[model samples]
Target: MVKVATFFAMSVGAFAFWQTMDKIHVWIALHQDEKQERMEKEAEIRRMRAELIRENKKRESLA
Candidate 1:
């Protein structure tokens, strides 16, 4: 019947939508982790720069 075929198509479409949503969620989570790691690396670089500046200042004071 036409009604039964329509129902089957809708079900398949819903399943495909669910699968796509799951993949999107996984991709978003992966990108979020990468962003966090990049932020942490930037913070470490800033900290190292500050430390070097302090050491240079101390050496200049001694001279």
Candidate 2:
């Protein structure tokens, strides 16, 4: 049927468009990006604390 062919073509085109854009991936990819960012931030906080402790120790030794 012609209608079925048209529908299929439209769906395929929509899917291709979605794949190319940086928006609206149906909440799947967004969640993953947010989770990864959270992990990196936590790691950065830990590294900063370690650096601060080392600096304090150095300052204490010099006093």
Candidate 3:
């Protein structure tokens, strides 16, 4: 009886651990995707700002 109870408890614990790990992996993946998107947006903004500065300099030189 004790052996059966112990086995059952261990089984439950292992299952819980597996589920928790799965959720953590999913969260990490989502976080990484968000980070990548943010980086891309920032790069685009920087490029736009650089272009605007170049255009303003051209206009000033012409004037």
Stretch of 10 with least lDDT, candidate 1: 1-10
Kindly report which residue pairs in candidate 2 clash with one another: none
Ranking of predictions according to TM-score = 3, 1, 2
Lowest summed-lDDT stretch of 10 residues in model 3? Answer: 1-10
**Top model by TM-score, which number?**
3
Candidate 1 residue-wise lDDT, 1-63, digit = tens? 999999999999999999999999999999999999999999999999999999999999999
lDDT of 2 by residue, 1-63 (tens): 999999999999999897867465657698999999999999999999999999999999999
- Residue 39 lDDT, candidate 1, scale 0-100: 100
lDDT of 3 by residue, 1-63 (tens): 999999999999999999999999999999999999999999999999999999999999999
Clash pairs, model 3 backbone? none
Name model 3 segments beyond 4 Å from true: none
**Deviation of model 2 at 15, angstroms:** 11
TM-score of 2: 0.56
For residue 27, what is the lDDT in candidate 2? 71
Itemize residue pairs with steric clashes in candidate 1: none
